[model samples]
Target: MALTTALNAASVYGAMSRLANRAQSVQTQAGGSGESGGLDFGNMLRDQVKSVVAQGNASEAKQAGLMAGKADLVDVVTAVSETEVALDTMVSVRDRVISAYEEIMRMPI
Candidate 1:
């Protein structure tokens, strides 16, 4: 009976430890940083923009190949179109941000 009680205690302790570790993992993910404990929005946005640009460049290359008849016409058109749209969206966002910055600067403090 003593041995069974000790075993149960050990099991309960083990389970608690596991739960604590899992809670820490979830907190880290939700907070987005292990040390600072918050999301880095600027870093995330930069990373996303970099990926989009890279994808657009790849699509442009594919489209160029299609133009040379080395690739299918439909594929080329689709890739080029998608790249154009992505680039346009990026440019518009940049313009809007710049405008907002300018407007903020013009405001009297």
Candidate 2:
């Protein structure tokens, strides 16, 4: 189990590194300096997850406020809808990433 975990971590790191390199190359080609500029994929994903969680929390808070007669129904509905969309987008990205990983694993090394 430890070996599998290590391998998974290494694979994710390698993929992120490759993506960062590609982004850096594109930026360089577009007349931008090749500085790191915080193009870390893991950090980006972490930030996005945090944003999604915040959105969900806000949506719940809005619903609670509506229940307490302190918020409008339209505001609650909008918050809930936005949260749903963000969650759905995150799930879709996860599925695609998993699918890509599986496909890569199936490839001959």
Candidate 3:
């Protein structure tokens, strides 16, 4: 049920599309060219996810080194903590985005 709700509340793309359209209009007006300088949300999202995956891999390597008695405990702790923080931040952002989407959907257009 929760999964369905989350899936139904996926309005972030709509919001991003509106924003991108606005940016494109402004760029076309200011630059007097057909090209829009706005960034792609899909690419940005993918890049951020890749960065988190890289951090997670680094953290895993640190833990492995620690187990081998070749790495400092401090470094291992830092890497794990950083990964946890990043995950927490991403989760928080996701929740907020979902909430915003739900709110927008509730609005009468």
- Output the number of the TM-score-best candidate: 2
Model 2 residue runs over 4 Å out of place are: 1-38
> Cα lDDT for residue 56, model 1?
58
lDDT of each: 0.61, 0.70, 0.64
How high is each candidate's TM-score? Answer: 0.55, 0.65, 0.65
Which is the winner by TM-score between candidate 2 and candidate 3?
Answer: 2
Q: Tens digit of lDDT per residue, candidate 3, span 13-107?
A: 23434554665567566655442588655446545555555676687788779889999999988987786687567668769989999999999
Instruction: State the local distance difference test value for candidate 3.
Output: 0.64
lDDT of 2 by residue, 81-101 (tens): 787688678779889999999
Runs of candidate 3 exceeding 4 Å displacement: 1-36
Candidate 1: give the clashing pairs.
none
Clashes by residue pair, model 2: none
